[model samples]
Target: MLRWLTRSLHRKLTFVLVIATMVPVILLGMVSYHTASTITEEKAKLTGVNTLRQVNAIIETMVLDVENMSVFLIGQQEVQSYLTRERSGASEYLRMIGFLTNLAFSKPYISDIRIIPFNGNAELTNTTILQSTLFQQVDTDPQFWKNNTKWWSPPLTTVTSSGIKQTVSLVRPIRDMNTFKTIGMLSIGIDTAVIAQRLRDAAVDGAVMLVQDAQGRTIAASSTSITPSFVKIVTDKMTNSHETERLNSVGEGEDNQVVITAPVPIVPWDAYLAIPHHTFSAQNRYVLQLTAIAVVLAVVIMACAVGYFVRQVTKPLIRLARHLPAVSLERAYRPLPVESEDEIGTLISSYNLLNENIRQLTEQVKQNEAAKIEADLQALQAQIQPHFLYNTLSSVQWMAWMSSNDQIANMVGALGDFLRFSLNRGMQMCTVQQELEHIRNYLYIQSIRYPDRFTVETYFPDELMGNQMLKLLLQPLVENSIIHGLLKTKADQRGLLTIEAETPEPGWIRLRVCDNGVGMTEMELHALRERLAHYRFDDKAALHAPVGQDTSGCSAQMKPLGGYGLYNVQKRLLLHYGERAQLHVDSKQGAGTVITLYLMSNWTESQLNAS
Candidate 1:
């Protein structure tokens, strides 16, 4: 009877110990799996949110930079000076070009900077070295000027003059400051690879980065297979939900995975993160294994009267389960008071330390953000200096006129007109008539300074009088003749400058500028043709040399003009008219030089007959 009672007591104790050990292991496993899964999912969501925010901030900064650049250009006294003197000296025009080139170099992202006068000429007034290599593209593309909107385009393959290929362009139309007309477009090429690298850097582990167009075509991607179907899926997910959600999908070996989609929010684009189900499921696997081991141990330990040991292990786990809600809610989690110094106590202490580290990291992130803002402000200030110089030049021109030196007065007057036209007062387009008048003013002033050195005669058919041309078209060529061709001739040689516009056929107006002065050598002619063919501006050193070096004679009275003026004229014309208008230059040593411009006749049958 005594032996049976002891056996019954032992059996009861064994069952109770087994239940105590197994129950906590089962419960802790569920609780631990839930806690870890929740933390990981929350972290991924936070990462997606933070990434979207950063992309937004980057795009905003870029937009602000573009706007600031536009405003700086519009407010530039040099643009006004260039436009004001559009009818005057090549020197004034060159000055404007120099200013523009400097601005282009200051920004690495700015592929090119140009001032297209409303004249019917394609000339490059000012350009970066890289832009000088791509003049042909600007000169041949009429859509560049006709398009009125500001936007970025997909990667466009284009060959440089030297025959190198590049991609993607950002274009913004520059308007006439006074009339608000679209005069020319400013194009900047983005290094797509660099942008891709930036996106890659922003991506978190398991995250996919993508850039898409409005049509949902992926233009660029990082660490993701960017297919049309994938873009469509991402686009649909982003459109359907404002809050990001994790979707279940089959993974390798039939395992489950979670897909989290987020909108990039810079342009219309989407990003995704995938977390495999195994990551979450693994957390519970260890607990199940421990429960099996604990069951067997409980049976043996209970037989030895070790029920108190089972309770000691299970109690700590129960306390840990109670503390989970606090940790999840970001509240302080204090472990329950423990009398025993064991591994379980060490885990609680480590968790508290981790929470403290996260808090410190968050504070540091806030401080770094403040520093970025200050750096951006400094960049803005650096961009404003050139505009100030332009304004000062204007005041100086006015003072020169008041001094009663007509030569200086005329030069200053021409300078003012050229600046004004270059400035465009913000307009994008102007009539050919306006452009011609501007050029006439420029020539008149040059003729004043070198009355005996150059003569200009214009022959235009009455029918083509109303035709429109881009602004500042003729000024550069006229300036070029004076500075490069005519000025180079000996005084004994007659510097004859002739301009004629006639319609041999009903639909065409051919304008010509023929000069009887020093002609170009093969090398010089090749360089000239290459420059015009490529639409490149001359080097600043070349543009600023003594008049004789760029031209024909060493005279103290020779005007100081930059070579970029002619380049600007050619670029503006080609951008507006396409192949319908072109520049042609013919020169023979000691014989003379002639430049003929071909354009479409802006005349109706009635108008032609009436004239």
Candidate 2:
């Protein structure tokens, strides 16, 4: 049974059960203990306060009795007449003495009684001697009698003739009734042991009690179990006027103990109550036993619940895990069937939808790839056929002008070089140096065709000669400018064309082509920008026109040439270089047209060689 309990699901569920059950149990125990402790402390404090109040009431009554007797004695007609007469009748003096003696013996706490005459000459009378002998003091110093009139005087030690030690004295003044002059004084002594006995009888068990004067000196202590250290703590705390209850560690070594200290009400000292830690532990032992039994029962219940829960949760997760390996990248997988309308069922539904979408997307992607390949092939054929025919015609013309036709021979040579460079041997990219050579070849052909009508200027940094570019890009732009802006004009004046290259910043190159010819109107320019912006490349054939056809003399209402080659060039540049390879066109009507191409500078050697 022990082994089964240890190895069962209870072991795994112990943490949950312990946290759930023990947390509240421990919290409730702590709160109960704290609240009980607080109530116990408050009750102890109240008991101490009540005891102190009782003691204070007893002391106040005793003091008031002493005061009343003193007042009564001072008011006695015999004593007053005696003070005025400078000597009292012996019988009346004996009567006053008898009254005081009766007053002293009436209270058990009072130990002595006497009277002293305050003679202006400071002479010791027979009565003063009697009182001094009773008090066991050498003399009642006149200064002690003179300075104190109302405040209680400091305690004096008194030893009786029988050799018993006692604390002597509560004293007050006696004044002449008519003149209100200080004539003498009355005194009384209280037995400190009697006060201690009263406190001991009234105090609760485990209580420390003390009585003190205004200076915080101990007048009496009720329990001998209280150490000097405890007395010092009470005295120091009382002296500092600290009244709050506090837990104090007392004694040293094996005698160490904790106690709660609370101030006594209307008294000059405090009371302390102490209980050992073992006492609290002993009281809580049954609580601990109940907690252990509850924890054991809780563990049993939680184990069964957790076992059911974990089995239910882990089974689906394990099933999902088994299906994970069947999910292939090349082919989509069907999900496991939903067993119920729970978390696992929702997961299964999501998985199935994800797989279905992935499979459909995969089939659509394959179709799109096939169609793209076919379209690329068609585009390539379209590009290749025109160059093939153009090259063939140039070859035929070159053969036709071999020797006798010098001008035609030159034209054929320029055209052959232009065609060879435009085809670029079917290469897609070429170096800036090679592209410049290709442009030079095209310009040579254009110059041959219109010898005195145009002048071409080329400017390039030696540093940009090695940069790579898309093949035939610059040539087309240059051809477009010459054909559309320069060739259509009938002016005998020279058309100036400029080709320039520069690097304005790191990792960037700009190549510009400027021509002094008829520029487009704002409306035509706007139309051109709108077409190029859309990346439409279906109008290439419409842009191409015969070399000598003139549009300069045509009516202003005639539309300009339309084409997709320029649009295609801009789109391909943007695709490769993003926004950085922008094509900027600036033109002024009849002044000039400038086309600029911006591109990154870090083209590879192989790309440059191809270009």
Score every model by TM-score: 0.36, 0.37
Query: Tens-digit lDDT track for model 1 on 1-611?
Result: 55654554444554666676567656665676576567656665566557756754554465456556766775576664454343646676666667776776676554445555554333443342333333344434457556534555665444444333334455566666787665555555544454566668886664556655555555456654556655454455344443453443434464334555555443444445444445543434565456556655655665455566544556666566556555642444344565457987877676667667766776677689889998998998787554564676677777877886666766766766666776676554455566666777778777776777767677765656677544455666777777777889887665777777777676666767777777878787776676555532333333334423532222333333564454445554554455456788888887777887776555333432332
Q: Each model's C-alpha lDDT?
A: 0.58, 0.64
Candidate 2 has an lDDT of: 0.64
Residue 417 in model 1: lDDT: 68
- Which regions of candidate 2 deviate over 4 angstroms? 1-24, 81-94, 118-148, 161-165, 179-181, 225-227, 239-611
Error of 1 at 368 (Å): 99
**TM-score between candidate 1 and the true structure:** 0.36
Q: What is the lDDT of residue 477 in candidate 2?
A: 81
Q: What is the lDDT of residue 462 in candidate 1?
A: 60
lDDT per residue for candidate 2 within 270-373, as digits (tens), equals 44444433444344456555655665666667666766665665677667766666766585566678888987788878878877877788888889999999
Q: Each model's RMSD to truth, in Å?
A: 46.0, 23.4
